[model samples]
Target: MKRSETFTTVLTEAHAGSRIDLVLSQVFPEISRNQIQNLIKAKKVLMNGKVPKPRDIVEGGEEVSLEIEIDEGVSAPEPQAIALDILYEDDDLLIVNKSAGMVVHPGAGNPNNTLMNALLYHYPPLKDLERAGIVHRLDKETSGALVIAKNEETAEALQKQFAERTVTRVYQALLVGELISGRTVDAFIGRNPYNRKKMMITEYDEELEENPGKEAITHIRVLERFREHTLVECHLETGRTHQIRVHMQHINLPIVGDPDYGSRLKIPRKFTHHAENVLRGFRRQALHAYQVGFIHPKTGEDVLATAPLPKDMTTLIDAIREDHELYVKDHF
Candidate 1:
C-alpha cells in the first residue's frame, strides 16, 4: 500500500507577487512547474488551506501545501527489471554509473521506466523514501556517476552535503570551439525568455517576468584541443540547471551535439569524411559526469566514484583525433 506525503512552505518577500506556479517551482526546484500544475489539477495542492489555480497570485507569508502519493512498496512507478551499472555500494548509499538517455525521475512525459523504477526493483526499501532515496540527478542526455542514499537519516545527511556545496562534481565536455587555455565563468543562470524549456546566462530585469537568476560558477580546464573542437574538464562550484551548457554557450564555446545550446552544425573544411559523419549523427550533448565525491554519512569517510566515457563519446573523440592528425600532416 502507498502513503501520502505532505510538503508545506510559506512564501517570503523574495517570492512575493509571483504566480502560484512560479512560486511553487522556485520552492521546489526539483519538480517542474508543469508538474506542479498537474498536481493542482489533481487537487493535491492547496494555498492558504484552499485549492488555488495555477495563475493565482501569492503574497508573502501565505502557506502553500503539496501532497504526493508514494508507496512503501513498488507503487505508481512499478518496479521494472532494469539493470543499474553499480559503481560503489554500502549499506548507507549506492553509487551507479547512469548511462546517457536515462531519465532519473518520472515526470510529465516520462511517468515510468526511469532510474527510479530500476532502483525500486534493485532495492525495494528505497520506495519508502522520497525520490527513491536519490539525492541528486543527471539530465537525460548527460551520463554520469550518481549517488543514492538508502534511508531517511542518510538522505538528510546527503542532502545537506549537496546544499553546502561540499560534494565534488567533475565532468568532461566536448565543445564546438577551440580553447587556448582554461577559464572560470561566474554568471547568473535563469530560464530562457524565448524558450522556457531552455536555460541561459542572463541578467535580472525588473520589468521581465523572469525570476532573478541564480549564481553559477564553473571552472574549466582544457584537456585536449582539436582544430575546431576542444575537450575540457569542468568542476562545478554551484549546481544550477544546465549550468555547464549555459556557461559554455555564454563563452561562445557551446558543447558539441547539445540540442538546445549548441550552434548549427558547421563541419570544418579540413574534417575527414568519417569525422563529419560522426558529428552529424550525434544527437545529444557531448557531456559526461566522469567523477563525483562526497563524505559517506555512516562511515564518515570520503567516497569517490568515477564513470568511464560512453562508447558514443569515445567514438566521437576518436574521429576528431584522426581528423586532427590528418589535417596536421597534410599542412606540415
Candidate 2:
C-alpha cells in the first residue's frame, strides 16, 4: 500500500538563518534528516511553492510545504515457524533476544529461517512493515536484545531515535588480550579497500575521501582481566558495520573466536589445557549485544532490555578465571 501526505508549517523568527533541511527535521521530529534531505533533492518540499535547496536558509514567516509519497506496505519475507526468544512485546514494538548464528534478515545464501521470517510467522501484520519492522540489526554471530516495531509509524519513530543517537546500546565481549583500563576508540570505519568483506578503522577524516566511511566510536571498560584475555563491556556511540569488532582490532584487542579479526591461533605456553581448549574451540566472535535502551515510540516512555550471556561465553569466562587463579598461585 502507498499513500501521500502533505504538511505545511510557518517558520518563526527563532528558526531564521537555519538550513531548510535542519529546520524541517526539527519541525517533524519523527522524520530523519536524511529523509528530509532526500525529499528536498526530489523537489517534494516547497517554500512558497518553489523547490528550495537543502542549504537554503529559512526566514521567519516563510510558508514551507512538504509533500511525500510513502510506501505504507513493505514487501515481507516468507513466514517460517522458527522460534524466537521474545523478551518484551507491546502494541507498538517487541524486544527479542536474538541468538547467535541466527541471521536477522535474509541475504545472499540465506533466504529462510531468519529472524524476519520468524517475526512474520508470529505477527502477520509485520508483513506490511519495512524489513518486517526491524528498526536495527545484529550481525549473524552477535547475540543480544533487538527491537522490532509493529507498524510504520512506530518504525519511523524508533529509527529517528537511532539517527539522533538517543538510543543506548551496550555490548559484552571477550577480547584476546588483557586490557589494563578502559579506553575509547574514535575513528572512521569503512570497508577495507583491499578486502570488501572486512571493515577497517581509518583516519577520522577518511570520510572526506573516496569510498567515504562513517564516523564510529566505541567506549570500552574493563570488567575482568585474565592473563591471556580480557572481558569488557562496550558502549556504542555510533553504530556501523562491524563496529565493535573493528574498533577492538584497531587497538590490537581483536575478539576471541572472531574469524575475521581474531589473532592467529596460538595458545600461551603457560596456559592451562582447559583454557587453551576453550579459546581454540570457540567458533564465533565473542561479542554480544547485551543491553539496549530507547524511548517508546508510542508511549513516550523509556524502555530498557538486557540479555544474559550465552552458555559458550559464560563457560569460556569460567575457564579463563580458573586458569588465571592457578597461574597466580604458582607464580606467587
Candidate 3:
C-alpha cells in the first residue's frame, strides 16, 4: 500500500528495553499505534534484520533499523519559480539565505508558494529521503541562514544534535530604544490564554503543545545603539516558538517592526510590509538568523554557517540609528 527507501536506523543501547511499539509511536507520531500494529502484522515493520513483534522489548545494546513506507503517495508538487539565495551546500547539507516574506514550509493559507515547494523543485529526489531533509525553519518574515539536510541519515543526526542542545543558533534584531552590552533572558514561554495564536511569558500554569512546555533561554548583546533604536545580536541556548520576539517584548524593547508583541507607540507603521504608518519604513520584522553552528552530522566535524543582513533591514537601521540616538539624548 506504500513505498519508501530501505531506511536504516540505529537504536542505541540506552533505548533498549523499550517496547517496539513505543519506538514506532515515537518515530511516527502522526500515525496511531493501531496503524503501526497493523503495519507490523503485515510484515511491514522490520528490526535490525528481522520483523519484530509489537510487544517485543528492545535490548539496550542492540541496533534497530526500520523501513517505513507510507502510502501517502507523493503528488508531484507543481514547481513555482521562486528565487532562493543558497549560501552554502555540500552533498549532505545546505545553508540557505531565506529572504523575508518566504514561508518555510507548506501550510494553510500558503501551500504552493513556500520554501518547501521550491526545494522540492530543486531537490526532487530528496523528497523521498527520510524526512525531506528540512531540519529547521525561519519565520516567514524573518530572513537569514537556515540549514537543510540532504539525506535521511544526515537529517537524523542533525535533529539529534538540535534535541541535545548541541547546535547553536544566533539571531539579529533591531529593537526600539537602547540596550545594555550583554544580557540573558530566562523565562517560561507558552501560548497566551487570551490569544492562542500568540506566545507570551507566563509565571503560573501554562498551556503546552501536546508534547511538553519548553524552557527558553536567550543571550543578547547590543551590537549598536542609535538614539531610539538598538541593533542587537541574540544567541539561543534553547529554541522555542517565537523565543526572541516574546523575550524581547518581556524586556519592553521589542523588535522595531513586530506588531504582535509590541504595544502603543512602538507598533510600527507597517510591520513594515503589512502597514506603512504603523511601524513605518521598516518593512518586515527586524530579525535575521545570522549564525548557525553545529557538528557535521556524518563527519562529526564542527561546521558554522552565517548569513548577512538583508537590505531592507540594513537601510531601515541606518535611519533608526540616527533617530534613536537623537531620541536618547533628548529623552534620556
In terms of lDDT, the best-performing candidate is 1
**lDDT tens string, model 1, 1-332?**
77898998666655567688866875677767778889999999999999999878887778889998765665367788899999999898899999999999987788788999899999999989877998887899999899999998898787767756799999999999899999999998877768888988877678855545666899999999999999999999978889999999999999999988889998999679999999999889999999999998888999999999999999999999999999999998
What does candidate 3 score on TM? 0.72
Q: Is candidate 2 or candidate 3 better by TM-score?
A: 2
lDDT of 2 at 1: 75
Instruction: Give candidate 1 regions above 4 Å deviation.
Output: 1-5, 8-27, 31-75, 206-211
lDDT of 2 by residue, 210-299 (tens): 324556889999999988889999999878879999999889999988899888876876989998899788889999999999999878
lDDT of 2 at 309: 94
* Total clashes for model 2: 0
List runs of model 3 lying over 4 Å from the truth. Answer: 1-76, 204-212, 265-279, 324-332
Q: List the residue pairs that clash in candidate 1.
A: none
lDDT of 3 by residue, 1-332 (tens): 57664444565543456577655554453345556678778787788668888878877444555556745454544556777788878889888899899888765577688887777777776677544577876788999988888887788888667756788899999887779678999986766667766777866434522222336799998888765568899999877778999999999888877878865455432132333332466656789999999999777788998899988887777655555455557658
Model 2, position 114, has a per-residue lDDT of: 93
Candidate 1's TM-score reads 0.81
**Stretches of model 2 off by over 4 angstroms after superposition:** 1-76, 204-211
Task: Give the TM-score of each candidate.
Answer: 0.81, 0.78, 0.72
| Cα lDDT for residue 197, candidate 2 | 71
Worst 10 residues of 3 by lDDT: 269-278
